[model samples]
Target: MTINPLEYSAASHPGLMRDNNEDCFLSQPEHGLWLVADGMGGHEAGEVASAIVRDTIERETHENPAISLLDTIQHAHATILKSAAQGIGAPGMGSTVVALKSNSESYQVAWVGDSRAYLWTPSREGGRLERLSTDHSYVQMLVETGVIRAEDAEFHPEKNIITQCLGMQELPQVRVDFVEHQWHKDQWILLCSDGLTDEVNDKTIAQILFESNNCLAAVDQLLHAALTGGGRDNITLQIIESPLRDNPLRKGLWQWVPYLTGKTLVDAWIFGAALASLVSILFYVMYF
Candidate 1:
């Protein structure tokens, strides 16, 4: 089967415990690219670095679709390094990036740092979630070496400590991984920051996506799961739903979920509080 044009949705939130949203995302359905980035450094610096990365990817990829995705990411990496060198960005500023790019029949996923991409598809037993990116982080190393179980890595104190990312001068060699998968109907792609995984487990995420009516509701449910489970960091995600080659789902530009209705009053209250928190944090990031 040929690859279908994708229908997509997205959501972002600062979560309850963070004072700023240091995450940024990009959606370019027309060009078949989407991204999620999580930044590190001080609050101000992290936000700036993430935005720079996001904007660079959007600009570079759109200008030349034939340019290699890895080359485009390297351009973003070089941009961040240049900004840091010139003092335009903060010292130690860096970001974790995960992106999905597609052609007419297959998709390529690439990542650096701990942000992730997952694929879900229906099966006779049940729908399944398959993580597409391996993290460049210390805890992940432990899991790889059998020093700890995969499940135990989540509870490890150093789970958030990544081994490599963009914008660090000492680490001249950063590793980026690329994977390719054939597209099919009833398949979904999820790109997200660690914030969502930190709060919601993989099983729960799979269940939510399987149960939801559409990609929009799945994104909402995922965000809700993260916020309600102690949103300790900025949360961001993009969902891409693949349709049949002959029939595609057409959607307008994605909007934040604040206007969604019909949930329990308590669910609405929780979402409202989470959104209010995000707005306040954004202002703090902007002005302070």
Candidate 2:
């Protein structure tokens, strides 16, 4: 059977401290594109920077369906720079972006600054949460150079200091880091601003995502977690479920298999035992 249309959910929230949310996200399954942009500057300027990034990508992808994702992001970078130069937002308005684009068989993730992308596979499929993008921040640099442990970088005072982003007047062009992966039926992609990472640890994030019944639930839990964790910055995120179809037998079997205390492995074992018992009964009845 063919894969179904991609499933996705996105949200942006002004945290407990921030009165205004400067973060923005896009979910365009039609164009196979989704992204999160975190704005920086001050007040309205940050909002403008992120909004420009969102609008530019939305418009470009809608107008030119075949445009390269990289070229589209570059176009957004140029637009943001032009807007800042023309005094549209503020003198130093800029934004960090992380985006995902996909085709039928494969997908690509690209980013600048600390906004991140992660891949999650189910336990039955060698479950794990893998970070797909690296941060362009001073702390990240320090971590890379052995100045600090990766775990320590999270709480470091310089963690928020990003090295580059869209619309920086000092740089003529921004570099976008990217990676590609073959699509798998059991994989899910998550894109988020540092707002989520700053408040929630990777281990907690993986737990929430893996335990969630669907993308919407995962988004809700993640947002709630960040807000509870102090919500120091604007929180934004998107979760994209792969389009590939699950095994037909497993999908049908799950319909009658009740969750056993939210433990997937235990529930799976129960399902297998029940199936085997049913098969043995049918064989006995038919033969005797």
Candidate 2 lDDT for residue 189: 96
For model 2 the TM-score comes to 0.88
lDDT scores in order: 0.85, 0.90
Q: How far is candidate 2 from the true structure (C-alpha RMSD, Å)?
A: 4.4
Clashing pairs in 1: none
For model 2, what is the C-alpha lDDT against the true structure?
0.90
Error of 2 at 182 (Å): 1.0
Tell me the tens digit of each residue's lDDT in model 2 across 171-245.
Answer: 888898999999887678999999999999999999998778788999999999999999999999999988876
Q: Estimate each model's TM-score.
A: 0.83, 0.88
Which stretches in model 2 have alpha-carbon errors above 4 Å? 247-249, 252-288
lDDT of 1 by residue, 63-146 (tens): 888877887777778888889889976988999899999866688999889999999985434578999999999999999999
